[model samples]
Target: SELHEKVKLHYNNFKGDPKDVKEMKERIEIEDE
Candidate 1:
């Protein structure tokens, strides 16, 4: 339950923080390359 709730909380935060989401996406892309 804690893991599920944490995931939900993070999802909401990601929506609220566009800059964070963008940076996370960029980091993901960089790691992929």
Candidate 2:
């Protein structure tokens, strides 16, 4: 599916901005916890 591919692409290309990546991970962890 396009959605699955897009997600994988985002993860692969996510090193564009360090702060953005860090914030995203923090948010995801907070939600999971």
Candidate 3:
């Protein structure tokens, strides 16, 4: 959970692009599976 939060924060700081965020989330989901 901490890692996820940190990643989200990092991403938010660098690229606050919704599309990229969504894509990253999707990639994370796939990795999780």
Candidate 4:
């Protein structure tokens, strides 16, 4: 759960730029596979 919290924190920290957030989500999806 720590990793999930960290990811959430990181996502929240980057909540300003939509482009970067979208890219981050895409990268996370790729890494999931």
Best-matching candidate per TM-score: 4
Q: List the lowest-lDDT window of 10 residues for candidate 2.
A: 24-33
Using TM-score as the yardstick, the better of models 1 and 4 is: 4
Candidate 4 structure quality by residue, lDDT tens digits, 1-33: 567667757877885679989988787666555
Model 4: how far is 11 from its true place, Å? 2.5
What tens digits encode model 2's per-residue C-alpha lDDT throughout 2-22?
A: 655565566567876888887
Judging by lDDT against the true structure, name the best candidate.
4
> For candidate 1, lDDT tens digit of each residue in 4-29?
55654565567646887777666655
Task: State each model's CA lDDT, in order.
Answer: 0.61, 0.65, 0.70, 0.73
lDDT of 4 at 4: 61
Cα lDDT tens digits, model 3, 1-33, are: 677777666666766578888888776666545
RMSD of each: 6.0, 4.4, 3.0, 2.4
Q: TM-scores for all candidates?
A: 0.52, 0.52, 0.54, 0.57
Q: What stretches of model 1 exceed 4 Å from their correct place? A: 1-14
Cα lDDT, model 2, residue 6: 65
Off by over 4 Å in 2: 1-13
